[model samples]
Target: DWVNLEAHELNIPKDESTKNEAHWNCTLKNRTVKVLRRWLNERATYDKYQDRDELWLTKKATPYSSKSCNYLLTRLIEEGDVPIPEHKEITWYSIRHGVATHWANHVGPHHAKEQLRHKSVTTTMKYLHSDSEMRSTAVEQIW
Candidate 1:
């Protein structure tokens, strides 16, 4: 698959969101573009690709599944020496949830809802994590 660098966006045919939200537009910045450039070069040289349309492929050149993505993340975390507590858990959905919480905090719940393309704000709220201390500080500052 080819990336349209000039447009500075990645067109995803499908996403984890609802059915109507089929097309997900991922914005690409300069840093991401640089990494993509290197990856594209590697993809071109990789054997067994067989002219596939998929952006990500395995050593066998098949399309990467959600399972593989999760596995890869685990391996990367271990390699990067990121600490994880025994009780804590991490998954692809967790990353998405964290982003949703961040968006809700910085902008507004409605903005996060729109960005996630959820059917309702209630659904978006399920993905967010609250910070009581932050809320307390904000309330104190309001006086």
Candidate 2:
């Protein structure tokens, strides 16, 4: 699940000054919007502020610090008692990397670039690199 909902739940207006509109719009999802609405509704019960601006205090609302977010995630992972994957250690970032890599390999570059909001095709290409062993197998089959 996306982590930024706490800020929205606290009724914090996004800091538009630093917002990368392109990046945001590109990655925005219907699920994220729905979660944000749920958070706002939950918070509204206890919160007295009526206006959107007041509810979402630009400076005072809890900031979504990535480091803290990761720390909390680590704790949750430990608490879940889930088995670790046999092949690799799964981290929060692996999900993003997997999505990017999957898109680049399966969907092609231009579509992947748009989905990822990557500034450069070269950056997107990095994700397209399949494992060397897999590449070798692919080449053998094709040739």
Q: Give the range where candidate 2 is weakest over 10 consecutive residues by summed lDDT.
A: 8-17
Best by lDDT: 1
Kindly give the number of clashing pairs for every candidate.
Answer: 0, 1
Candidate 2 displacement at residue 101 in angstroms: 1.7
Q: Model 1, clash count?
A: 0
lDDT of 1 by residue, 1-143 (tens): 23676677676565543555566666677999888878878878866664676778877667777788888889988999999899887777788898899889989899888777676999999999997877999999997
Judged by whole-model lDDT over C-alpha atoms, candidate 1 comes out at 0.78
Listed per candidate, the RMSD to the true structure in angstroms reads 3.0, 7.3
lDDT of 2 by residue, 11-38 (tens): 2223432323432333435677687678
The pairs that clash in candidate 1 are none
Report RMSD for candidate 1. 3.0
Error of 1 at 87 (Å): 1.6
